[model samples]
Target chain A: MSHKIKGGCQCGAVRYSTDAEPMVTFNCHCTHCQQASGAPFTTAVAVQRENMTISGDVIEHTQTSDLGTLVHRFSCAKCGAYVYGISDGFGATAVNAVTLDDASWVEPQMEVYVSSAQPWTHMDPALPKFDKLPPMEES
Target chain B: MSKKIEGGCLCGAVRYESDAEPLFAVNCHCRHCQMTSGSTHIPGIGLPAAAFSHTGDVTWYKIQNDRGGQSMRAFCPTCGTPIMGQIEGEEILFLHVITLDDPGGFAPQMDIFESSAQPWDRFDDTLPRFAKMPPMGE
Candidate 1:
């Protein structure tokens, strides 16, 4: 059975819960992510938008992604901690898997946005990868 | 807190400078970074949002981050060069280090999100590292 996962914004004012298993999990090394998280790549978990339940006031910022897809960034209205994003490119919502209450359970399967990755950053040797966001061919 | 820096998008559509020192510097090894930069690690420098200054119109795009944060990427649509981004927790706009007028002036202090870095990617051994984004003040 799929496990339930819960998460919230930095201030804990915004919370979310989901019973659906993640559709996918991976790392995005794109410049946007590098700039956003101030890290090498952002670790994310994806699930259907319908499976998630959110509470509290969260602000959203929408833009057309570099891939030409619409993406919405969800954050806490008060603390501005980013909680998740919905992408037309993947037809799914990606939550910062690290923010999940049970962070230990999240597992990443692939890595995207590699082209912009830093020369020094080294990824796992086994995961499949693409220089940029790979097309969402699978569900 | 980091040294003051200056940068903007490629087309000159956006021009801004910042006095805030980077809180941290990192090299991203994710696929999106590679594609966005057409290379490995999008070496990025971070500064608090309040420390920046700019003049010029830039465009933006929102994207999904691995960590579940809302990502606002600002760039010059005309030249298609990314300028900066504003993320949730970190109270700053992430300036694309490359977009800096003097890219050589900035250097990454550490590496984060190393779990997704590529095997062949070469980075300087002198920087600090974390498997994930390190906690602040670590």
Candidate 2:
């Protein structure tokens, strides 16, 4: 049940699309993601970089992830809306699910970095939770 | 002494300091918040405009409500992290809670704009929920 996924920045300065199925969708409660997104957690739809097509100029800001891996964040320069992230910790590009044209279909498989999650943030208990990133095979 | 509430963007380019205590904490599930933050919702704290000070080059995006009210969202140009938002005609400005140096101890009173919330987005059932913006000025 895969469909074309599309989305863009709030200001319409950037846009992206992909027909490839997402590798995995999960929530990231890492402090870096929290600060980067201004949300309690970031829902990431991991996809292959080669299958994704992006238009418009994106500002890349590289920083150290909570995992101590170098993560490259790409966002719209005009609106500062995050588009996707590339990090050494994962093999696929982590696309911000909320940025999708219709994010209602986003279903997270797990919640990571629960140790850094805020007390006010309520999550679905049915999903598996981890204090930090689990082994790639286990994730 | 308690810790000071101060923070900046992911790249440490945009910095802010708030000396006052939190006035209100809320989680907005509006579509705009989702698109801007690239997350399910935005958890922010409202503070007196006078007490909060910030420094850095910020990229501002303006959104107009159906009632003609305007809201301004500020993000860091260097790091692309949203840090602040200002509502027109309002005395207090809202800051993203996660922007705080210590982004803990935040307790949101309610959820607003649940009408547009994504299905996969979860919430605390204990908190009050509103389909859209609640009536202001009691």
Docking quality (DockQ) for each candidate: 0.09, 0.81
lDDT of 1 by residue, B40-123 (tens): 356777777887888886655555677797666665544445456676566777676766655545567776777765544545
Model 2 spans with C-alpha error above 4 angstroms: A66-68, A137-139, B1-3
The TM-scores of all predictions, comma-separated, are 0.58, 0.92
Q: What does candidate 2 score in Cα RMSD to the true structure?
A: 2.2
How many backbone clashes are present in model 1? 48
lDDT of 1 by residue, A1-139 (tens): 5657787754567788888888778888776555444345667778898888888875555667787778776655544344677887667888876567666565668888888776646576678889986665733
Estimate the TM-score for candidate 2. Answer: 0.92
> lDDT values of the candidates?
0.64, 0.83
Instruction: Judge candidate 1 at residue A37 and give its lDDT.
Output: 40
